[model samples]
Target: MLYIGVDLGTSSVKLLLMDESGDIKSIVTREYPLYFPQPGWSEQNPEDWFSALTDGIKELTKDCDKTTVDGISFSGQMHGMVILDEEDKVIRPAILWNDGRTQAECDYLNNEIGRDKISAYTGNMALTGFTAPKLLWVKKHEPENFAKIKKVMLPKDYAAYCLSGVHCTDVSDASGMLLLDVKNKCWSKEMLDIIGLKEEQLAKVYESYEVVGTLKKDIAKELGLPESVKVIAGGGDQAVAAVGTGTVGEGMCNVSLGTSGVVFIASKEYAEVDQNALHVFAHADGKYHFMGVMLSAAASNKWWQDEIIGTKEYKKEEAAITKLGDNNVYFLPYLMGERTPHNNPNARGTFIGMTMDTTRADMTQAMLEGVAFALRDSFEITKKLGVNIDRIRINGGGAKSPLWCKIIADVLNVKVDKINSAEGPAFGAAILAAVGCGKYASVEEAAGKLIKVIETTEQDPVIVAKYNKKYDIFKDLYPTLKTMFDRIAE
Candidate 1:
């Protein structure tokens, strides 16, 4: 049997085809434009995503026997607000998870609404990236558009709706919306009331690996597949990626350094993890997970390499860096503001301690280390929750960099394992599809059979000690510049 995994990403929709045994058959990607209507505001037309998803599916399954495709599922960018009218027409461009234009609404939720009360209701602090704040922003600033919201879904759920004709979302993705009462696995009525939204506007929730609906006849015929093809409820990218990496059981961990970075620790219960709370999200495995997110990870390097350096020779540029944990320069990877520890939307990317003697390699190394240190900030929080993590399964675009992987190993003082496939989210989506199709007994079994660690980057004791001190300085920089970041935004 074959399954399809559609990863609806920020810049592209990546589709993967795999067998029941987890062998990848084919892969295809379709790119789409991202819009920045204003600085710090990010948006994408849901129509563009739907087009990419459908077109990519056709290309992805062209060589295979379409009848054998048992299921299709998704792993998508979470927390994006995709609102639709009564007729299901998109009301506006989706407010992407990386967008920082909802600071005012986040402030209102965290302060006027009271953090303690909001946390009690949703198990998360209101962050600018969350869907609720984006909704509040729209309601306050664009009331006309807000009034048209008849159903709301995350990025992937939109594609699910297009395929299966079901207005539905999975627990993992909805947890990021700041509207789900995560512990209870339901929408928080308090949050709905706060946003002045009715329950009918939201999608029906499901577990990530559950079968939500079958393919619509029209969509199935268009994609050269059967209407009997099951539409599985795949998950938010991070949770599903954890499944792909075998991070399903309690205390198992996966760190993703994709467009965004996440330090994800899978848990079985919904209890509070720490004083920081550390982003308590519903896991794709029908449980819970604690996550710490950075808005920019490989994206920061992509900007430096593509937009600024004018080259895609990332490895060639990385080859220039001979120093590890020894750079004088420091970069704050806040190109899209921050989320994890310092929920600061006003934060801007900064390069400090640069001198005339600073080489491109030094600055490059700083960018890499800066992201590692930021992830380490989350690792610290997980440790505070008494979660013992000695090794982590690492996957993402940044995981392809040997230097960056080694830096992550030393910075976190743990073994970083690289799996066979770098397509974490897409692969995980396939696993969810497999589980939904009864190809595997459970997600854990599917992951265990499929994911193989190809290599491990062992931590260097000397570099680890060096980074321990460097991280101390790195953590302080954000706090020191908080007031300045706020002032500059004004």
Candidate 2:
């Protein structure tokens, strides 16, 4: 049998087709426009996602046997606010995960309500990107829209509803909403009351690999697929990406350097809040994982190469940056504010320690090293919890850069393994569909058979020592500039 995985991303929708044995048959992508009506705010129409998925599926399965398709699943951008009326029409353009319009609501949750209580109820602290804060933003500013809301769903869950005629979400995806009791794997009534929502407005929660419903007959007919095809409850992009990298069993680690950078570490049993800095969320493999995120990763490189240097030749520019950690110039990678360690919305990107002697190569190296140091901040918190990780499987666009991968390896002092297939969340979603369809017995089993490492980048002790001294200095710049960032923003 065949399975389909839909990766609903911020910029595009990517679809993948796979056989029962985990071999990919074909992959397709459809791009969509992103709207920015104001500074620091991002929005997208959810209807575009459904249309792209339907069209991409048709293109992906055109030459293949569509009748053999057995199941479908999704890995989606998390924390977007998607609402529906009584007739299930989209109420407004979705507030994207990167939207920073929720600073007031976040301050209300973290300071007025208190982070301790919010963490106690939701198992995570409030950020500007979480669904709870987005909900508050809508209620305070768009009162008319809030009054008409009949249901609130995440981005990919909206597409699943259109395909399967079910309103549901998985625990891994719900963990980012700030409305779930993540430690307990259920919705928190306290959070619901705080957001002025009842249980009826929320979708039913399910495990990531469970079957949600069969595909709607109309949808199947339009795509030339079987009506009996099952739609499984999948996960958020990060969780599913972990599965694709084979980071499923206890103590496994996966590092992703996409638009955002993340470090994922799996645990055999549920762990309570530790440090409360890193996210403690349920994993798609029916266990638990701790994750740390950097708001800008590969995006830092993109901004420098395209917007600043005026070039699309990333490889040519990076080829000039030979020096790793000895550059005098330094860049604080806060282009999108920051998340993991800082959690400061007022923070802005900065360049410190530049001189007349500094070259473009020196500044470029700083951009790469800056992102590495930020990720190391999160790794320190995980170490405080007594979690030890020796090596991590790396994925995403940044992972394709040899210099960046080497910098991450030496800075973190962990070996970085490059996988043969780095298709991101779309491939991961397809693997989840295969598991749900009983093509494989368990998630671990599926990953063990599918995820393959093609090469490993080992950390050099000499380079590691150089970055270690530089990281200590990088950690101090944020606190010193915190007030300045706020004052300038005001």
Candidate 3:
């Protein structure tokens, strides 16, 4: 049987067709517009996503026997607010995960309500990107729209609901909403009440690999597939991406360097870190995991190359950076504020310790090293929680660079393994579909059989020592500039 994985991303919807043996048959991507109504606010039309996926699926399965398709699942951008009216129409453009318009709501949750109380309720402190804060913002500012809300769904769940006619979400995606009692795997009544939301407003939560419903008759017929095709409740992009890279089971780690960077560690049991710096969330494999997210990773490099340096030749520019740890210049990768340990929206990108002799190559190398050092800040928190991560699986655009991977391995002092396939969240979603169809016993079993490691980057002791010293200084820059960032923002 065949399975379909729909990765509903911020910019596009990617559809993947895979057979039961894990061979990818076809892949199709369709891009949609991302709207910026204000300087820091991000939004997208839910209809655009569904339209893209529907058309992409038709293109993806054109040459194949559509009747053979057994199931479909999703992996999507998390924490976007998608609300529907009583008639099931989108109430407004979705507030994206990258949107930073909830600062006031976040401050209210963290300061007025108290971070300790919020953390005790949801196992996380309020952040500008969280769904609960966004909902609060809507209630305060767009009260008319809030009064019409009948359903609340995440980005991917909106697509799932459109296809299967079932309102559903999985544990991994719900964990990011700040509405889930993450440690208990249920909706937090206190959080819902605080936000003036009821439990029924949310989708029914399921494990990532569990079946949500079958395809709607019209949707299945429209896509030239069987009506019996099951729809699996998938996971958040990062959690499902972990499944794709075999980052399941205890102590397994995966470092992603896409637009945003994440250091994900799978755990056998729920564990909370100090100050709630690292997110404690449910894993796709039915266990628990911790994740530390940095808002800008490859994005910083893109900004430098495209906007600043005016070049698309990333490889050519990186090829000039030979002296890795020897550069005197240092960069702080806070292009879009920051998350993880700092959680400061006022932070700005900075290039410190530059001199008259500083070359473009020196700055380039510093930018790469800066991202690695910031990831280490998150790793340090995990270490404090007593989670021993000796190695990590690396994916994303930056992972394609050997120099960047080497820098990360040495800085973190952990083995970095490069996988053969970089399909990421889409591939992981297909694995969930397979498991839901009984092709595999569980998500872990499916991942173990599908994911293959191709190369391993080992840490050099000499390089590690140099980066350790550099990281010590890099960690101090954020604190030193915190007040300045706030003042400038004001």
Candidate 4:
């Protein structure tokens, strides 16, 4: 039997067909528009995601045997607020996960609501992107629309609903919403009370690999697929991407270097407020995971390459950056503010230490090294929590750069494994689909069999020591600039 994994991303929806043995049959992508009505707000239409998924599925399964497809699942963008009315029509454009319009709401949650009680209920403090804050934003600003919400769901759950006609979400995806009781694996009643939301307004929760429902007959027929295809409860992009990179069970680590960077650490047992710096969320494998987020990662590289240098030849520019540790220039990668340790939405990206003799390569290298140092911030938090992760599987656009990979391995001082597949969340969703269909027994068993590390990047002690000193300086820059960033924003 074949399985379909749909990666519902911020910019596009990617669908891939894979056999039970983990060989990919076909992959296709459909891009959609992102809207920014205000400076800090971001939104997208749910209808766009549904259109893209259905059209992409038809293309993904065009040459394959559609009848043999046994299951469908999703790896979704997390924490987006998608609401539906009683008749199931989208109330408004979804408030995207990257939208930063909820700073006021976040302040209320962390201050008025009290971070301790919030953390006690959800195992996390509020950030501007969380769903609870978004709901508060809607309720305070758009009371008419807020009262009309019959259901609230994440981005991928929206896709799953389109396929199976069931309102459901998995634990891993729900963990980011600030509405889930992470330790208990259920919705937090206290949080629901605070938000003035009913439990029935939320989708039914399921484990990541469990079957939510089968495809609706109309949806199956439109996509030329079988109606009997099972819809598996997949996970958030980060959790499912960890499964794709084979980062599961205790002490396993994975770092994503996409538009936003994340340091993901898995644990079989949940920790009750180990530290407030990193987010504690339920993993897709019926366990828990810790994540430290950076709002900008390779995005910093893209801005420097495209907006500054005016070129799409990333490798060509990277070829000039030969040095690893020593650079006079430094970059602060808070282009979209920051999360994790310093949950400040007022932070801004800055460049310091440039001199008359500074070269373009030095500036570029500083941008790359700055991101590495920021990621190290999260790694330090995990270390403080006593999670001993000596190696991490690397994925996303930045992992393609050997120079950047070497920098990351050296700066973090860990073994970096480059997996065989670069499919990321798409492949992990497929693995979940396989497990849900009973092609494999559990998520870990299927991941162990299908995912392999083809190459590994080792750290150099010499560079590690240099980065340690540089990182010390890097950490101090953010604190010094905090007041200035706030004044500038004001």
**Per-model lDDT:** 0.91, 0.90, 0.93, 0.92
TM-score of each: 0.89, 0.92, 0.94, 0.93
Model 2: ten consecutive residues of lowest lDDT: 268-277
TM-score of decoy 3: 0.94
Whole-structure CA lDDT of model 4 = 0.92
lDDT of 2 at 376: 93
| Clashing residue pairs for model 3 | none
Candidate 4, 1-490: lDDT as tens digits:
9999989999999998999889999999999999999998899999999999989998999898888999988899999999999999999999998898998998899899999999999999888879999999999999999999999999999989988999999999999999999999999999999999999999999999999999899998898888899999999999998988898989999999998999999999888645478989999887999989898999999999999999999888888986788887899999988876788878999999999998989989999999999999998887777889899999889999999999999999999998889998999999999999999998999999999999999999998999999999999999898999999999
Supply the global lDDT for candidate 1: 0.91
The residue-by-residue lDDT of candidate 1 on 275-384, one tens digit each, is: 44488999999999999888899999999889987898999999999989788799999998887887666799999999999998888899999999989999998887
- Candidate 1 vs candidate 2: the lDDT winner is 1
After best superposition, candidate 2 residue 474: deviation in angstroms?
Answer: 2.4
The sequence of per-residue lDDT tens digits that candidate 2 reaches over residues 65-149 is: 9899999999999999999999999999999998989989999998999999999998898888899999999999999999999
Q: Top TM-score: which candidate number?
A: 3
What are the per-model numbers of colliding residue pairs? 0, 0, 0, 0
RMSD of each: 3.0, 2.4, 2.0, 2.2
Pitting candidate 3 against candidate 4, the one with the higher TM-score is 3
**Order by TM-score, highest first:** 3, 4, 2, 1
